[model samples]
Target: MSAAPPEEEEELALPRRPPPCHAVCSSRAFATLYSLVTYALVPAGVVALIEVRYAYLLLFVAQLLLAVGAVEWSWLAFRIRQRLLLAVSLHEDGPPQPQEPTEDAPDSSEHPPPPSSDVNQSEEQTEAAAARRAHALEDQPLRREDPRESYARLMAEAMRAKSFAIAPLADWLFCGQWYLAAFVLASLGAAASVALGYAVESSVFGSANPAAGWRMMVGASVEAAFVSIFCSSLAPSGADSVVLVVYQACVLVASMNAYLKLHVDVIASDSQVDPLFIILAGAIVIIVFRVVTSKVVMQSLLLVLCDVLGLVCIVSPLIAFADLIDQPMGHSFRNQFALFVLVVVATDVGDCLAKELQRHWPQVFQWCRHPLLKSEATTKDVEALAISLACGAIMIVVVRLGSGVSAFNAVEVIVLLCAMALGQWCRLWMAHVRQMAKVTTSAFYLSEGSRAGGVLDRMAVFLVAIIVYYPYIKQKYFSSS
Candidate 1:
């Protein structure tokens, strides 16, 4: 490429300046207090609660701060909603009123004396001037604005934002609901297990000298459920839920063995001495479930399940890497955590690619009719599929070679990523709807020759998204890394 002009290069090379608010904050007491509360007190309290015996006091303070934060967030949301509503209402109201004619003007009945040759010529010039004045006056208001136009603009924006929230709900009805159900069930099951464990351990088992039976029942139930939920959410197909249920039951039985070992005061060091046999048995059951389910059920659920699993796969690695950076080695805790994230991402990508590949024929037809659809397809689809397959194959090889690898964290990350994607999708739909409405209103107003006003309003959105969110994302995700 040719080198850019000096002036253009100079413009591009401009340095970033701190935001006005950032500078103002350094000068203001209230802003400083706000910073202290959010950045200092809140985090300190949370950490103190986690690592200290006097944590209850900090926890109480944290809760109070949280209450204040919630109120502030709610208020901000309310204000935004209100402004949006008002803007919509105002658009529907139309433009400003036109100015009326003045009462203090010369009457048509007034007549001057009969003009000679020179007087007639002067009168003709005067009449032409008056005509031009009237024309200029007529165009002035059109150049300014009609208040009604503003109302129409707001109406369009309101409609768009409204539709964005609507479309996702409709889309979710067909595809997202089952995944939603699974997520809810897993979370609920976890909550129930925690509650039950706490209740039984505190009340039935007694902290001073708990009954082995009750403690085993509570601990086993909680741990098993955790494993089950984690496994099912990660699985591409099979009786995922059923597998989890079985795992929980088997673990319950194994808890008796654990209690016996504890009673004997056994301190066996090898992996074989651990109660991991129950976990191994659960995996075997899942493998069996996968085989049986393949033969019995239609594989539609597998596709959706895989997609959900894959999404978690992609995000998990990043989180694990983040964790690994924080964690020290020697007692290197679950290095596979990051790898699992990769696997989840890979699986999700694979699932998506497989589906996309399957739809290639249909996509071809779609592209024939909708050129834009073709343009939107990117390498991401292909890359994700390849990664997923690679992760799965690698896991298989690792298993065969007897190398250690954990896919759980990867699975969790992918799932959470899917949830995040869903949230973003919803937001995107809403934004698109709002833009369309705004553009339509702008177009209608522009038809009457309102160029500067229309462009200003249209450009504001692009500026905000680019100037705000893009930088925020870069800072959050890429800056440190």
Candidate 2:
């Protein structure tokens, strides 16, 4: 009979290998775990009830994709484990070690090593050794390609990250039932804001005001439309650029809208009715601001100012209606806004911690007597964990306190100051990291400056301009004092 084909012969060979010793094959368990935890528990059907905003549904879908990516991430870890296990098993079954050369050959220095006579023999031995090594190396690369390896790596990374978990958490939050939850909360906040805005205009300010509550709503719609259109146009450039531009625009428009609405409230109470005049004036101001500033420093300063202006938007109104700060509508709105700030702050802190841990942990553990895998209770590691926990806790507490404070009060100013100070401070200290972070963060989710030289050039000019304009502006608009 003809010899059997190699594939059939191999398949017919008796199975020599034992079953995997570990229940999960150790390598694949975490991948299975991640899939279950992230997809089944988090980012599932539950989040929808919490947020309840239609816009959040889009966010939720994005988050679901992220979670799915994470689930996929665990594959690396599984592959690594499998490779390690194979290595261990192979090592256990490998041939016995050969004996060392007896008495060795004559000492190399004394005999000058047996030269050309042994050259052919030595070459043959070297070639044989090379063949053996090459054979050993053959399966390693193939083993490395295992999908589980990626999942394992991602798990290890996720476990270590602290600062950058928001995007991850957002994925988790968006994918599951909690996505609904986030939607609901956002919806409720939006609805509450709209209702309060209307009630304030119609009941408190009177329907006869120059810009009715309805008109304010229309203005807000226009502003939002402008932001959406601009952002969409930029989207084709790249996700990061799109996110950054859109986020900045949203912040700017929201701030400007709030500022304009507050001003409209004041004007409606007493001023003239000339829609074209206000529009023309606004357009002129925009042109001047855009035209006069060409330098990077000026542009960055303007960008920050616009961001700060968003806070100013909500702040101005509360300050104007200080008596209403304690009222239910005002207090509720303030709490909600404060919560948003807290969330952003929390995200920043988490991302920073995760990044720091990622960069420094290897060096920090290098000097230990035993590696972390063996040492369960290293003081240094404990200290690091403790510090991280403490910081996270303090942030949570501070955010809670912020939420309780009335908007436009001392607490509110302090919070706003904190936001500005932290933003600038981070911008200064983590300039490079921030650039990297902006791109990385935007890659998942979607969301600069410098200035002049000398002390006098920077401060004196700045002071003179501020002093000259501050009084005039305050006297014109904020002159109750």
Candidate 3:
């Protein structure tokens, strides 16, 4: 085996520097702590919230944040919806303007200069060149954007961001109708989750197969629906008989969708039309119907019953679409899975910060002089070990919270750490060994870098957890219904 070129090591050692916002805020250790703390807001962790005393306190904190952020959320969502509507309208208006002629193309003219009789076509080539230059000159006004436009774009982006990260809890606290909340939640919450995962991917693994942000958004929206349903199904309430049926139905419906996704081909369409917005539209229709029906001189209990049934109906089709899209659809109930997702975002952000700190300022970790830490390939190897450790810890915590501590649970955590660590070590070790020999023409590295991307991390953690906890999961959640 031949050694990889020096460029491979250089790439690993020097990633693109993060944005200034990240450097000052999310990169800090405090941000990692904040990430874990936000998990309390994830209503999907009801299994823990109901059982753990600490979680009860966290519930209050989560509630407080959500309630306070609603005003901000309302404003942000309104702006985003306006943008979405306008953008969609313009997109449907007409075919996009034709691209400017390139230098290689024929001259653009109503009447072309007769194809030059010369066989070499020198005159034709010159005319084409002149025409291309003219086209470029004409494009300058549209291409050269104004500074104010850039500022407005940035501000719009900032607003879109706030809509996703903030806002939730005290479902009744928001000013909008139920469907309005659902629409914004579906759009911003689902889109935010997708965006966070994408944000980490580039630094960790730049590859030939570029990630598709739109497909990811569609999928994340699907997962959002399922996760929310899972969390909502676990909501605690003191109810007798028939009311228990509502909660029971919620759990059954959720698990049913999970199975359908795993086993059935459910989604009828795979075109570019985003089913998420369509699902939200469906919810809106249902909500509007319920609202209009309430105006009649009917009993309040009947009205409440209709509202609950309408809510259930809305989620049913959303889950069904999720099964077919091979994507996650969440939102409508952002509190459920929204904050739990920060675990990935935080870990990725923190991991990059650590590497950045080590590469640029090794003195920060100089206090720890362990033998293993002394490797020449310090930056990349350490990053791999960090991923293995981080993945192991998150799995342990999440699994334990979902299913209390057990003998098998201990073994499961150990096995996962062993698998992840060995995988990371073997990959890095082989890359290092390969770098010594210069065996191949191509650059040899385990992946683009050792730092983990949040999207990959979440996928890896969940995949491992499913395999390790399949039996327990089947017995506890699936069979419970």
> Which candidate achieves the best TM-score against the true structure?
3
Q: Where does candidate 2 have its weakest 10-residue lDDT segment?
A: 446-455
Q: Per-residue lDDT for 326-395 in model 1, tens only? A: 2222022222322332333334334434446545644533433444455443443443334445545564
Per-residue CA lDDT of candidate 2, range 1-481, in tens? 2344333355457353221121332334544563354334533332332234221122222222322222111222222333344445445676334323222222345434336777866776566656655654442333222335444433333322122212233346655332343344435544555565666565545545565435545444343333333222222112222222333333333333433445335333244333334333433443354345435444334333432332232222222222121121322343433333343333334434544664576565456435436654344434343443445446556756754543335443344334433332332332332232222211121111211111111111112222233333334334442
What are the models' TM-scores?
A: 0.26, 0.24, 0.26
Model 3: weakest 10-residue lDDT segment is: 439-448
lDDT per residue for candidate 3 within 1-481, as digits (tens), equals 2333333355455444231123334344644554464433343353343343222123222222222222222222234334444445445674334334233344458435546576476667667777766765554333334445544443344323222211243245555233354455445544665666567555433454324433333353345443343222222211111222232233323433342233332312342334344444444554455455546433223334433443343233323322322222222112222222333333434444655766798776656556565465575557546854685477457755765634334554454455445444434433442233222111111122223222212223322332333343334334444
lDDT for each candidate structure: 0.38, 0.34, 0.38
| Deviating ranges (above 4 Å) for candidate 3 | 1-80, 89-406, 409-472, 476-481
lDDT of 1: 0.38
TM-score of 2: 0.24
